[model samples]
Target chain A: MRAFLSSMVTPRALALSALALSFFFMMTLGGPFYYLAAFVITSVFSLLDMVGGQDNSDNDGKPWYYANIQAYQIPFAMLWFGLIYAWYLGTGMSDLFGVGGFLKTHTGFDMFAIRARTTAPELITGGYCLATIWAGFGTTIGHELTHRTWSKVAIITGRWMLALTSDASFSIEHVYGHHLTLGTPADPATARRGESVYHFIPRSTFGQIISAWHIETGRLARKGQSIWSLHNRMFTGWAMTLAYAGVFYMAAGWKGVIIFFAISWFGKCYLEAINYIEHYGIVRVAGTQVEPRHSWNCNQRVSSWLLFNLPRHSHHHAMGDKPYWELNCYPDAPMMPHGYLTMIYIALIPPLFRKIMHPRVLDWDRRYAVPAEYPLIVEANRRSNTADFINNVAPAE
Target chain B: MFSKIFGSATKPATVTILPADISFIVEPKKTVLLSALDQNIKYPHYCRVGSCGTCKSKLISGQVRELTDKSYTLSNEDIQAGYILACQSVPKTDLVLEVPKLRVE
Candidate 1:
């Protein structure tokens, strides 16, 4: 049974598995309670990440790359990803023919029914459910697809997924900006050694936005086009985001529009939080090459599987064009103690996150970093009070 | 690190690659994929540990030292076809090879 299940757990399926959650959230619409249920299930997912590190089938299965498995899945997943936006069109409109009626038969969503006139708290909670599902799952799938060098269709679909998050310029900043500058002082995306998740959010998010704008403008100017022209990729992304919002407005009315905005804002924040943990405290010198040492990796079984091996991030940076299934676990890369879901939770609590991550970052410096980088790493760690925290946690003679 | 511990200390070998039609010298005991990349020639590779098969190539001539056990990566049929992972095959002597055409984004 496990083997059969494992066989079905291909990367493409894993990528949009959370699309099912939004479906559920749609069904549960019209009530604060159902929305609460959607949000609470996220905690269950986090718990699974904590306990589910064992993979019985990894030892026995055919190598995941056999017979061009990923080739079929990527297209399938991208299509479904588009369908998700369509699904939102239905749920967002909330009152489509037989839609609310169909969902109402199974769920208690009343005032906040996908189409019902809802209260503020219900709107907030329901939006939160949608936000968590799309941000966590949709953004993940989009990220995986966007990294591909092939398949323009797949790449555009992935960018649209980020458009759903109201942060479509992610493709611009991430591909051109983050890949080039990750772990360096010049990088807006890489969190500094002492930076907390809360602080990192606005800095990375807005800074990347500014950086992406500049990048797109530079490209347009190089091609002799005005920055305000449609030739600017950043403008295209933002325009798509607005169009997506217009569809959401049509789906559920003004309430639908507001809820979509709420979802987008929350989802954008969640995506940034993820970025915060991906390369926290790792430093690189300006204009130097990016080695596998820059990004932190997690090979936790369940999270990596569900997230399509995203935890094996070192190889992703090393070869950004490498497909998700092709990503390898670099033994020499820095590792995160917990999977992404767990670290995400811990990151919210600054002291706790530091206590757990700072020492590990230090270990990365000592073990993996070149000696010339030692002073910078040490100074950064000291500023974060990592040494004092270590002394308190475990003092030595 | 793998080069320091397991790489040969012998003289480097000159390698010619097909498709790209580029020739580069591989440092003693270093893999052909790394050598091509070191010379600023875009070479197709990922997971340089002989895993992903992205660097699979046909070893047309000469000899190379296989750095990884490819029992899992390369099938018997593949081996018979002269297919070797460029990332794992370090040149033992001057060699000619063909790399699969790959588009790097």
Candidate 2:
């Protein structure tokens, strides 16, 4: 019983289980207000960062659960997707048993539907709630699945989730481009000093797609296959998105289409905002090596629990295939002031972001960066207009 | 010491790595990972100093000499499980290897 219970309650499993709660929240509260509620939940987690652990390490032994966890989650993620799809389309059993209906039955009053708010406003939030599901857990699930090299199903399903976000080529660029060139000028995914979410999003979105295109083209080219071959992953990804969009059009007309893009737009921004903060201002030589210091890490327990220790990012970079439950908190890696959720909220205000993170970046340089790499670090700061802040305040660089 | 472990004097050896299903002959005395990088074949690695264990691979069918000590770097079970650190080992004979598909750059 103990082993059985332990297997079911692993941190990785618990983090994924949090996805169902988001759906429940949506079902309980219809319209744009649910987003407000979700945002507050995130804010509360953000404020609790003070007590979060910084040096937690994974336990040495793998639970019997590790083998079957992915197999278990795939169906769960799919069903979660199905429920959100039903709610958004206002179709099938969801037409009566959906968010509005659920509220009416549960509380004996449906404030949203009883008050009879206009479709335009409800639809606006309806789209947002749907997208929130995608970014919050859908993308997280996709990220986990895409890491499996042996399982084509996991890869395809992961890409399928990303395509719903209109980012089908994430695995291609993520594996070949971002990983190969992280913390360097060559990796467009690495947010430079002074690069805000607004600025980073467009550049990363376009650059990643372009990088995936070139990377895929070259890969196929090496095999003597044409760029236009059915093997082109970039084309296949975009085709998947188009097909998904077509399904939305047929189901709910222009309103559904609008909702799809809106949800995708917001989801992509959420995804990129997390990216913007993850590697902000860190630089490494293009082809040299990667260490724990290249990535910024946080260990706020709530964020770790919710995101399955994604905040323990230094370990992720160093041991790429290590499961989330197995990731360690490296003492030497750069630390974030708050959990990922709160830090993302902080990133919206560029000045505060610089105030907090710039000093940390410079400190990482002093401790980990070699003397030969100093020039590169200095140049990166100068190019980003952060040198003055770094030089003036850092301990006698 | 590194050059001697990965220099021009020794006989070149073939390394066959999978998931990619590609094989290539590596420079004499060079770490199998260095040769992979030179060929732009993607292989996992972190902290080239034989820590992090990111480059750990299973030696499917070959002999390798560890340039760095594996006593502390790899667990005894891993060594018994046929795992070799690609970044710290040179093939003594033609080799076959397997790795988990994971993140990279």
Candidate 3:
């Protein structure tokens, strides 16, 4: 029975369930409660993580199952965008192909009435939900598929998913820029010690775009093509984002445009927040090999199930080609004190996050930092106004 | 259809590293750098994701399935000279590579 239950509650099942629940709640719940889908899902998963404990079992699941699950997100994400556009269209602009009227006639469901009654506070909550869904579904799957460099289908789908958050450049910068320069000062995604999530968001947001632009231009230059051409991925990606904004504009006018940008910006900020925590305070000497210890790992059961095992990040960095299901739990890597979602909540409050994480960083310095890395760690601490624990230490000769 | 649904079975491909006089069989679907590392042959590598270009080697002979675009890291001259990232290249046939960074005892 235990074995059967374990097989039934697989990661693929959990991911599919998340999509189904999100669809059901947002579709069925009218007015204010429509916005609570993401919040409820995150809350349930976070609670489960805290109670269910860690799962370090080897993930020997079939690759096709996980791949299909990720592919399913493409249609669901498109439907999510379509639903939001319709909601924004409202009673004032659109009858949504008279589906609203049909429902009103047949089911007495008053869709237009619900839209009319939705308050500003309700819309704010709706925006937050949109951000969460975008971050959770779009970014994670996008990150996975973009790494599949060998497949054209994967790359196109992945870029479109990231384009939902106005982050298509991530497909270029993350694989080429951040992966190469991670854990060093050169990496824009790597948060310096004592850097707040607030500060890291803007710095990383702009830094990634600029880095991606340079990378695309350089690639084009190698191919003897102009950056001004449509072949420039940054240009094409930005065009896709603008097209999305155009759809939102058609849906709800200026207000719809504002809401669209709001969701996109919030989604980008959430990605940066994840980045801020993933490698917070970890340092490595430039040109040194990126090892498992460079990334912080989490093995919390619920978070692992919901996140498609992104918590096994250290192994991902060590071997990028391995599918998400194949990512191994590197037990010796530096670990996060809480699940990924729980850590994101803690990281929001800068002082509290530092208070919890600073000691761990110091411990990493003592145990994980090689002799060559001692000076780099010291300098990082000094520059970031970190505690004076490693201040007096000199580089080992 | 089975291969499409589930990945194809592993078939070992021979890899010969020149200058260091190293030879290894790259397991099916495994990148050359990883296969070398698996066999305890220290083929120098930093980021295995074709980013840092630390694992760039001259493909002396044989076909390879390049996983990621190498233009981001390798120079035009290097590409013209047949350099490929071992970390991103899976041997499609028996491969002979000139790895300048291969650590020799």
Candidate 4:
């Protein structure tokens, strides 16, 4: 009994169970209409995860992934409660004042039934706000966790939350593909120099998904594993999503599923937009090994708070396994000019960004240049005589 | 070796201002911006990573070498027009750069 209780209470299982209960309770309370909406939202994310969650195994062990899971647990739990409370407040407020009466006096809308039937206005709006925050935190954590050694519980919990945000596939592409070939032309996530966020997102989203399919297919072929194999993360994610949609269809029907998809897609897009901003214009030099300088860093306080310190990006790239809470600001890491949100707003204006960024870039360039007295020639000459002694094989080898 | 690493062996270069008739001594290995900052000269900068083009300026004359990290932020056109990142550009020879005073907003 104790062992069973402990298993049920593990962070991964707890979160998964909470999300499931929330989905069912909300649907039952709001009727089939709301349930369909939730289903659609989750199913879409499930599909994305199916495509995105491919081979991301690394021999480096699972400490980092586990750490990320632990780091995100508290914040996500808080966000979940915050959403629930916010919904309760919004509905109570609307009903207390009689939404129809309030609207009739304020906006002059004649649809009495619409206002009267505002079952949970606060719940709808507040739920969305909280959901957005959850999506951000959960998706990042889920992405890391899914890459760990197989834990049936972890996979289900992580992938389910990821799908609800319509970003399930990020787990696969980011860990498996992007990290493996980061800063290279082959990696879709690495932004080219002078590329804007607006242009990078659509291309990366589609490109990464297609690449994920090829990666998984190749992996299965090599290992003699069938596409239908239960061990496949991609297959499992898709199957769960399809199963979810079927559940939605059975419980609340198509309408609930559609609504769920719309909201989840919106959340997913928001997350992707952030990904675009996080590493915009940051590229690793082709044929060179990955280095910290290859990724952009932001240390702004508010953006860091909002995204659980995700803006301290260069370090994350250098050590993807570091838990979000423990991620540090490295002085040598290139710094973003502003907070992530402010930068996102600025990214919309290419010319303004270019004008503002040009000098800073030039300044950084000039700062890192080698001194004239210590030119490459001088260093080469100094090393020439020492080279033979160091190698110990004479010049023949 | 210690003196060389600390940049104490070399005599600092002087930048002579034409109209003001004032001059400042610039330390070796310090970018013009850093030197100016040391002398309490505030300059504009944002996203110091080179992605946000905030700190661009035209070089009037003289040679400047860019730090390796800042190279990605500059374009060929910028190099041709004598534009360099003040934050990145260390004076190779004495430099006469036409830089806009940092805005006081």
Predictions in order: lDDT: 0.68, 0.69, 0.79, 0.52
After superposing candidate 4 on the true structure, give the runs of residues whose Cα lies further than 4 Å from its correct spot: A1-131, A147-156, A242-252, A348-397, B1-105
Q: Candidate 1: which stretches are off by over 4 Å?
A: A1-40, A54-122, A378-397, B1-105
DockQ, prediction 1:
0.04
CAPRI classification of candidate 4: incorrect
Residue B53 lDDT (model 1): 61
Please report the TM-score between candidate 3 and the true structure.
Answer: 0.88
lDDT of 3 by residue, A1-397 (tens): 6765575576657666776666555744546675566567568767877997987876656456545665555446654554554464454638644666777799898777778777777777667777776777678888888888777888888888788789899999999988878888888999988788999999988999999999989999998899889999998988878877787776676777778888888888887888899998888877777788999999887777667788899988877777787888877789999999898889999889988888888888878889888878767877886554445353342
Q: Model 2 Cα displacement at A336 (Å)?
A: 0.9
Per-prediction DockQ: 0.04, 0.08, 0.61, 0.01
Pick by lDDT: 2 or 4, better one: 2
The DockQ for candidate 4, computed on C-alphas, is 0.01
DockQ of 3: 0.61
* Strongest candidate by TM-score: 3
Tens-place lDDT digits, model 2, residues B2-43: 546443336788888775677888877777877887888777
User: Model 2: share of native contacts present?
Assistant: 0.10
lDDT, candidate 1, B1-105, per-residue tens: 654565444787888877667778998867788778878877876545454466788989998778654533555667778888887787767898887583333
Q: Candidates 1 and 4: which is better by lDDT?
A: 1
Q: What local lDDT does model 3 show for residue A236?
A: 90
Worst 10 residues of 1 chain A by lDDT: A388-397
Q: Write the per-residue lDDT of candidate 2 for residues A205-276, one digit (tens) a residue.
A: 889988888777766654457777678888888887777667667656676667667778788888888889
Which residue runs does candidate 3 get wrong by more than 4 Å?
A1-19, A27-30, A38-42, A60-63, A78-82, A93-110, A388-397, B1-13, B26-30, B103-105
